[model samples]
Target: MKTVAFYRIGMIICTSSILLLLISSLIYNLLPDNDIPQMLLLRDDNGRIIGDAPFAPSWQFPFGTDREGYDIGYKLLEGAVYTIGAAIIISLLSFIVAFGIGIIGGFSKFRVKSFAHKFFTSFYFIPQSIIAYNILYPVIWEPMEGFTTTLSERIVIEVLVLAIITVPTTAILISNETEQILGEEFITSATVLGGSPLFIFYKHVLPHLKMRLFIIYPKIVIQMLLIIAHLGFFTLYFGGTDVCYTPFCHPPKPFIQEWSGMMGTSYKELGLSWWIFMGPLLCFTVTTLLLNGIVKCIEGLIDHEPYKSKQTSRENETHSFESHSKQEKFLFIKN
Candidate 1:
């Protein structure tokens, strides 16, 4: 009961927060001028300027302001859609690709399953983040002239790369799980009862896999978030990284204010204006924790031990009721 309560509470809070962030960001961007201040300065009672940009956390700006005077809190709110939404999309695409391949490989002959397992398992040796960075670097980084691809194109490329890189190990794991399910006694019984592979998978394996899939999805999202953060540290922002070679030009910046992009762009100011980077870092930390919490909730909710015990108790009760019915019928016959 406690676990179930936590699951409900955790889901509600997480879902509500994400919806709020996405909706607020949408409305904020939909304004005519899309007016969000680029700079802000603090003033005293007499209206004399007291402080410049990069203010500490205060009532006026809860998460404080960056060197450029943009509100860190508002930037986080606006970028929530990009960071969270993109991660969700990438994770979902990978899961879908993995699912199809795994289902096919799982239902195949032993040789096919073994080949898939051995082949795809090798992908685990590759460092996903490093490989992703190497592949995505050229296209996502602006050239001396300008970006060859548009922001949308770059984003799509990144998504494909990220999703494709993760499919190997995930598909292998899914295939293995499917094989295990296929080996179950019930699966054998179904097969003996003339159930086809397709029918058995749909009726038996799928129901069992559903809970695991739900649990795995959040884990994949967590991996994606970590990958995005790592890519940011590697100076590969989600959309594009603009490197300014001009002497007086500001440091390299991401095209968007996504959380990873924000972290990448602001890390240089860690010494003096730590808040600039820490603001986004804090948001990332919190979001990761929230996701982990959700994973835990799902884990607790899906624990088979308690459910199995309950199922056993119900079966026992049914047996006892049947025995009692037979005794009453015999007593009536003898009477």
Candidate 2:
């Protein structure tokens, strides 16, 4: 059989997951409530309710349901946009900022690079999840009266906070990678050949950097996902949390059906019903696995890509030299 790229498998899995989630979200919006099952309790053939809502994993409900009778699977599908979509957005924003800063740090003087490197290196010691939770809790958690900020505004603030916290660490890694690439002899050779900084970078440096960025991008996405999940554990969910602070303290509710939100709200069910917690937890695990798989595939692709290019170039050079040598011999010593 011919060789097949590992990245294609990753792409298929990723694309199918996203499309499934999008379709579920679309169906949720377009279809009526009756179309989607919301069973209050288990019913017998006689149509008499036997058990309460929040059913366990059964033929009727594969993933099970929450206390409100909403299917865990359906909620996951609808919330995929909020969860994965937001992770992607945050990662992209963080990447853009880190990439710009990294380019400067990579190209700038020793002092600038050193300061940046040393300063940002300190952030690595602090756990990202803890930082995200503290920063997000105040803004997203509803007060006694109600939320001061609108849903969109709160989401924007949360996204920005998450993106910003990641900037320091991501930038440092990018800067280091850039520095390594710039240290290559070809870069110096290109410079000696009178290549402009922009030209040398675009032609030689960028191709290498692109591979690193590809590897880095998915890693950042995975990181953002973990941070968001941690925030969820703290009940600092995205789209804000609505808490009831009355005499009977009702549990906080999430504005969206997000995976993290699902986990945050249903974590208490771990004692009473473990399946609810498992639903979202499994989702996060699968998503993380997929992202990690993508990372592996990309690394594999990068590893082989250079070898293939070098081999091809060598073959071409040898072929050209052999042809030229033959031509010279024929012309110099013809009978």
* Candidate 2 backbone overlaps, count: 0
Q: Please give the TM-score that candidate 1 achieves against the real structure.
A: 0.86
lDDT of 2 by residue, 1-335 (tens): 01235566766777577667666776675666624468787788998878988899888789998887888777777777789889999999999999998877877777666766887899999999998878888899998888888999999998899999999998988888878977887667556555576765665666667768988998999999999898888888888888887887778888877889889888889999899999989988988888887778777666655534445434533554465456653336668
Cα TM-score of candidate 2: 0.86
Q: lDDT at 33 for candidate 1?
A: 72
Q: Report lDDT (Cα) of residue 24, candidate 1.
A: 82
Give, for candidate 1, the lowest lDDT window spanning 10 residues: 304-313
Measured against the true structure, the TM-scores of the candidates, in listed sequence, are 0.86, 0.86
RMSD (Cα, Å) for all candidates, in order, is 6.9, 6.5
Question: On a 0 to 100 scale, what is the lDDT of residue 265 in model 1?
Answer: 77
Clashes in model 2: which pairs?
A: none
